[model samples]
Target chain A: MMFYINQTSCISPQEFILFDDNHILRKATGGKLFALEPNYKNIPSAQLRRMGKAVRFGVGAALPLLQQGNDVNGIIIGTANGGMEDCMKFLKQIIEFDEDSLTPGNFVQGVPNAVASQLGLLSHNLGYNITNVHRGLAFENSIIDALMLLNEHPLNTYLLGAVDEISDFNYKIELLNGNYKQQSNEGTDFYESGSQGSLAGEGASMFFVSNKKDAAIAKLEFVETIHSSDEEEILNWVEGRLGSHLIEMDKIDLLLTGENGDNRVLKYYTAIESIFNNKISIARYKHLCGEYATASAYAVWLICELFKNSKVPLHIMKVGTPPQKIEKVLLYTNYLGEQHSLMLFSKVK
Target chain B: MTAIVVTGLGIISSIGNSAEENRESLIKSRAGISKNNNFYSRYSTLLPFGEIKKSTAQLMEELNANEKGVTRTSLLALHSIQEAIEDSKLTLNQISSSDTALIGASTVGGMCLTDQLFIDATTASKGSEYLSSYDCASVMLYLQNRYKMKGIVNTINTACSSSSNAIMCGARLIKSGLVKRAIVGGSDSLSKFSINGFNALHILSSDICRPFDANRSGLNLGEGAAFLILEKEEDCKGKKVYAKLSGYANTNDSFHPSSLSEDGQGPFLAMTQAIESASLDASSISFINAHGTATENNDEVESVAMRRIFEKVPAFASTKSYTGHTLGAAGAIESIFSVFNIINQEVYSSLNYTSPIEKTGLVPNLNYRKTSVQHVMSNSFGFGGNCSSLIFSKH
Candidate 1:
């Protein structure tokens, strides 16, 4: 079954709130990059104060895409470290107070599915709801869930998205584990540094997906996720997918790679580039959004914007000549050479 | 349509370490709830829990996993996952193949190391090995890396119903021709985070939990892991097919974050829809493994839902008396109990029940007995009003 994106809302470090205007595209550096805050005038003050970054962004991004009268039969969300700020606070409380008289607010709101559940409660969506917490592949897993929901119930509209946040505690852990670069550097020129780590970033992206093609920004042709580090395994996966879909390599108009200046994980993207003989136009998106577990979701939102505008971002370094017609865009991303995901998006013509 | 069958079952909870042992405990009406002495917890003296006897070091030694960063959650999951793979007779090649999907559910994951996380956050040390093992997906990632699994691996966290959704998602994936087989289940070890959280909610029972009873206090927080190997009937022709996973439905109550609606609409819809999907009548089910958390709201609402669905409310029992509330693993653990009912043609008794709630006037099966069992419906409801029901029929 084919899935179409009816509406999308994104909150990233970039200035654009949704898919409207993109006048100020800020440069994401190697240090921590937080998403641009959105207005929360729609939510009650008490409820907004209780929510953490993930929930605030998640609800803020989702409310705009949901139509007033339309029924949402499903809600699926993805997050790597959900409500990290609250979780850390609870952990510290547990230790500081000698595990006595702990606060309930942090503990209650720290769960990974809090965002999805909050949305359900806010909108009174009494349908199938779930959350995936896999790193790197979380958003892809959400897409998979949405696809299955559409296939099982063709008439249902689903809300699918991902949210992740970077707190001081989480950032320190990432820095210690050699996941983020300590030195500041321009993200657009990430590969030029040949740095050991990528920039730390956080964001939330939500999409209103439906089987009906009305009011859609793009058509989700296919989405696949594979956990493999071996080059041959990944190549075999690509080959099998192409053969099963009956699509030639040349039919792929553009290749979106997640190259975020981390040389250790950049080889996987390079291998794919070589397999296609560097023929297809390759585009990079980590510069604009930095890197996170669900950064690929941001990349997907970026693709939707690209399709709507019919032009690539000026900061995205082009590898080859642009295709005559950008009909098929295949996104390939791998994090720390562990979880590899691919998503194929086609223009809604 | 290809029928999805459960060919293998694995479980390790406070009562027993394997399916047969747990079944024995069930038949003998054994309860594993006690003071939380086995694990380090300030609530050890104040609250009761279903904590496994084995320590993390013991688990590591038995599993031969001396890795520095491995957490108790991962170890528990690996123990059951290995048992499941062995019970299914799947070789290394099959498990590591691209067609075998692994879907794990966990509410706490490595966050069970709450103390260590607190230390890491407070101190200025460069890092501890436990840094990466802090989210709900860490255990799944550990398994993926350890087993060299190449299939689609995902993690689900919807509070208590996490594993039930995992099982449903796994079956759907196979039905959609995405994979040939699935290793689906969840694991959760006792931790201070959940204990304190549940304590704050005033839901953690100080005494042993009593489900559907008039004096039902609160729920005793528990922890363990259970996994089921699901494959198509055609592929498992000669294998021992325990039961067929026939129907499943997930619904949200949208009433409260921590409580269900008064009418139990989520539970009602999930059960009725599952029965419909199974192509069976409400009377066809032989038994039901109820999501009896022993909390004040859950048992009452669940009983009301049962009354709405079945006129007689078939021979139903809550195995939480034996396993406590295993959180993410509750669904899979109760599911295994339901399968045991189908295979052995017996009904396990519910313990610590003196009187039924005045509202529902429903009483569960109070004694274990050998009987003709054909189909069983398992209910798993979670926080945030996430409710799921699965129907398993005799294969």
Candidate 2:
């Protein structure tokens, strides 16, 4: 089934507004990197006060994609560590107060679906709302859900998105777990230089998808996920997805890898790079967005940008000359040496 | 489109450990709510809960899941998922195949081990071993690793309607030819975190929850796990098909974070949409497993919604009285009950239900009855104004 991306919105470290040519790609001296703050002057301050950073980013990213109270048939979200600040606050309250007189606000905000449901509650769209919280594959799950929904109904406008946040506690926990580096380093050359850990980053992206091709930003042709270490398995998965769509390996003009300057996890991307024979134009996003579970959501947003501009930002794109006519872009990201996800987007000409 | 068939069933709840045991409790009108004993909390002496009798250690020992960072949520999930895979007669190869998908849901997850999480996140004494168990997807990832499931594994958390959404997502994946079969359900073990969280909401009933009761005060928090093995009709040709997942719908109240609208628009739309999806009229519904949370807000709103949908409301009951609100697991746990209604051709009573709400004047099925039940509609509403309904028809 063909699904068109009607609109896209994202809140990341880099300015997401159109015509913003600023390239801010540097590893954080601080441990955590926050998404660029979006103006929320329109939302009620009372309701806004109760939300956390993640909720604000999610609602901020989603509210703009809707067509002023349009009947959105589904609201699907993907998040790795949703509302971590609220979750940690609630957890802290439970521990400090010894389970006595705890506020309900933190607990309410801690839910993974809080962002999606909050969007639905705000827009008054009583359609299907679900939140996928599968570590690295969270946003990919949302894509699959959007595809399945469109395949089943073929005429429904759906809101699909992802969100994640980093709390001080979340950052500390990751640091203790050795998932991120404590050392500060410039990330512009993230592919060549970095410590043992990748910089922790958080962001949110929302897409309005439907069967209608009118006013679409891009067309999503294929998406798949696999948990495998076998090179042949990965190759076969990609080949099968492209083959079923009657596309070939050489037709894939660009490949987006989820390499985040972490040498340990770079092998997965290297394997994919080998499959494309180093011929396809390849780019990287983690240098700009840093490393997080749903960082691929940011990669997808970047893909939409490449489709619109046909220009790859030099600060993040790595290896291979840019294709003269960017037609098809493939995204490959793996989290924690497991959960490998691949997505293919094509310009809807 | 291939019909989604329920070929296997598993359950571990406060009242029972297996599907058959739960079925028996349903028929016998056994209520599981009691003073919290297995788990200790500040509200242990004050509120009743549907706490399973087994201790966490005992569960881990029995399941042979003695590993670092293994939480009670994973243990409960393992028990139910193992039962489901076995009941489906699936081999190890099939369990590990890329054609099989596992969709699990849970809200508490490892947060059930609140003390360990607290210590791990705080003071940081060698970072407690349970640090990795706190996310909503921990239990699901643990199960996926256990079975080596590779096909579209996902975790969903929409509060009370989580597992129902998981089940719906699984079926949609199958219908879209993404997977051949899916093991779908949710698990949540009772913990001080949820108990205190609900207590803070001022919705924890001190007595056993009286769902649909006119004087119903609040809900009693509970936890457990339940799973269903759903396969395409072609794959389950000769299998024991319990029921067909005919239709499902989810709608948002868009009204509040924790409360439904006074008109019950969310529940009403969910019920009507689900029936319409099944290509069946509202009157075709034989029974309804209402989302009667027994809270002052939920019961009345659900009744109003039911009145708006079913001209003559079908024989409906809130099994939440049997298994206190299981949060993320409530959807799947009650879905299993709905399937059992189709399989056994019986309608179980809503335990402790007294007079109906004065506004709608709707009384649930107060007694168990053996009848010809063709379709059973189950409802699950969550804190985010997420309301979902699923229709299961006899195969």
Candidate 3:
């Protein structure tokens, strides 16, 4: 049994939008590309007070849209570097203080699941809860958990979310590695050309998933996660999955790839684009949101939106006419050469 | 329609080194928790834990795996996974390396090594090798590379629910026909990072934790590992079935980021869903293995969750009072404990309890109790409102 997306929110370099409520995103932050901060103070000052950047950003995005008159059956979050700031500090202390002279506060919040745990505490939800860290696959697997749980327990709605923060150590590493792409030209009076690199951006995206479809914006069709990077298997699997549907590859309108403007990654996308050709709209979101392990989480969020709103924002485009009605979108991503995930979504009109 | 069957299990915790040892210890009401034995901590006067008595080096020797970079955590994991994989009657090398073998190695893995690695990242070239050990997912990759696991190798770090989620993910894979078999569980070793983390929150008890007790001080931080072999039923036909993992559910309390909601709503919902998934009534739950970290908030909230759902909340006990909270390993650790109790038809005592909490008046079984139990429900709740409960039934 497939679950439906009731609502979603994403805090990224792009302007915030309810994931399923809107479709088609444009580069709204002037291509200046910065983390999208939310109005946490608006809901309740106290809740936002103790929240670190990760908590504030995640809750600020999901809590609002998931206000469905009920506590979600579960909250599933995947963070690549959860409170590494606290963890790093704790590590520094253990090293300096010789282990005995330390406190557990930072260490307590250091676990990857801490993000989802704190959210549960604040919301007073004591249900099935989990936080997964498979890098980019984290979000994909979290979605899989949410969907699987819904299938097992029909009424158990879920808040499936992912948050990645830019840490000094990691951010610096990306820069030296040439993965960050911040262009030098005058603002795009907007010409679309594929780039070779993009700045690393970080944010949290959450979806209110439920068995209830009337309120759903779209249906999460199929999600596949593979460890080997064998392009042959990936291609065969993709085409095989497509064959299982009533519609064929030609029916797909939008294809999203996890290209952070890195030439190597872009080349991977080109390989994919070459396969799709001009038959489908190809979009690279790394320029808009940068690259983090779970960046395609935002890609999945945007594709759902594009299908619902029937337009693509100028910020995430390469080319092609905006479709009148979108039917299918495929989200593909890879992280550290270990996990490559592909998620297929179908509009629920 | 498909069913999830738990065929093999393995564990290395404070209470026991294997499933039989754990069962015997639990039946005797023997507690594995004591004062921190290995780590030199400043809070020794304020916090005690379910720390393993053996040193990390000794544990490595016990496993005969000193070269595995021997964090007591991975060593513990090696013991458990090897047992589980063997119990499953399957070998990674025999499985064609083509079938996806997903192992959910959770924990802030290698935190113990992190302190040394951090000091070395700046000090020596040998230290750089430890950098790969820092990431939790790296543990799975290391194991895959070490054992040549031909299947999908992955890690899930869901805190206390870590191993439970790992088990759940693996079960789903088998049930959905996505994979042939999976080796899933969690591994965590005690370290100053976790020991003191609980201390700072003032949640660590000075003595052994007394879950559900009014006098319960807090949890005794402990560390260890646990795992299970989840294979499709067709493949496990002739194998001994330890228990049928009937239902499992995970929920996030949107109430707070750290503490559970007032009514323990998330846990209550999770239990309800898990029970429903098993297609059984709450009455069928002959015993309940509570997460019972023994912290005031946990005891109160979890008991409230139990009360809200179980009309007669079957006699329950928090084995944490014995093993200490093993962080990520608690889920699998306790799951193995539950199956052990089910097989033996006994409930372990919730050691070191003086009285029951005033709110629910729920008292964990502090004395060994024997009963013909058919199904056992186990719960694990964590920070970030992460909550999960699973139902294990006798075959």
Off by over 4 Å in 2: A17-27, A67-71, A229-236, A239-246
B122-233: candidate 1 lDDT, tens digit per residue: 6888678988888788898888888889888999999999999999999998988889999999999999889888987888888899988999999988889999999999
Q: What tens-digit string does per-residue lDDT give for candidate 1 at A72-180?
A: 8879999987788988888777777877877788877888888998888888888899999988899999999899889888988899999999887888887877888
Give RMSD to native, each candidate: 1.8, 1.9, 4.9
Task: Give the true-structure RMSD of model 1.
Answer: 1.8
Docking tier of model 1: it is medium
Taking the tens digit of each residue's C-alpha lDDT, what string does model 3 give over B229-279? 776666667788777788887766556545777898778877998898889
Q: Write the per-residue lDDT of candidate 3 for residues A1-349, one digit (tens) a residue.
A: 4678878788887675534325444352422345768666544786556556666677677767655465786678878767665677677777687665476656765567667766665565656667778665778778777776787678777888898876654444344344444452223322233544455568888888887879678888777666655566666655655666444677776787775545544444555667776777776666566668778778878777787776666555565655555777777767644467777788877
Candidate 3: what lDDT? 0.71
Q: Find the 10 residues in a row with the least total lDDT in model 2 chain A.
A: A17-26
Clashing pairs in 2: A27-A187, A181-A197
Going through the candidates in order, their DockQ values are: 0.74, 0.73, 0.36
The best candidate by DockQ is 1
Q: Among all windows of ten consecutive residues in candidate 2 chain B, which has the lowest summed lDDT?
A: B117-126
Global lDDT of model 2: 0.86
Q: Give the distance in Å from residue B314's predicted Cα in candidate 3 to where it truly belongs.
A: 3.6
Ranking by TM-score: 1, 2, 3
Q: How does chain A of every candidate compare to the true chain A by TM-score?
A: 0.94, 0.94, 0.85
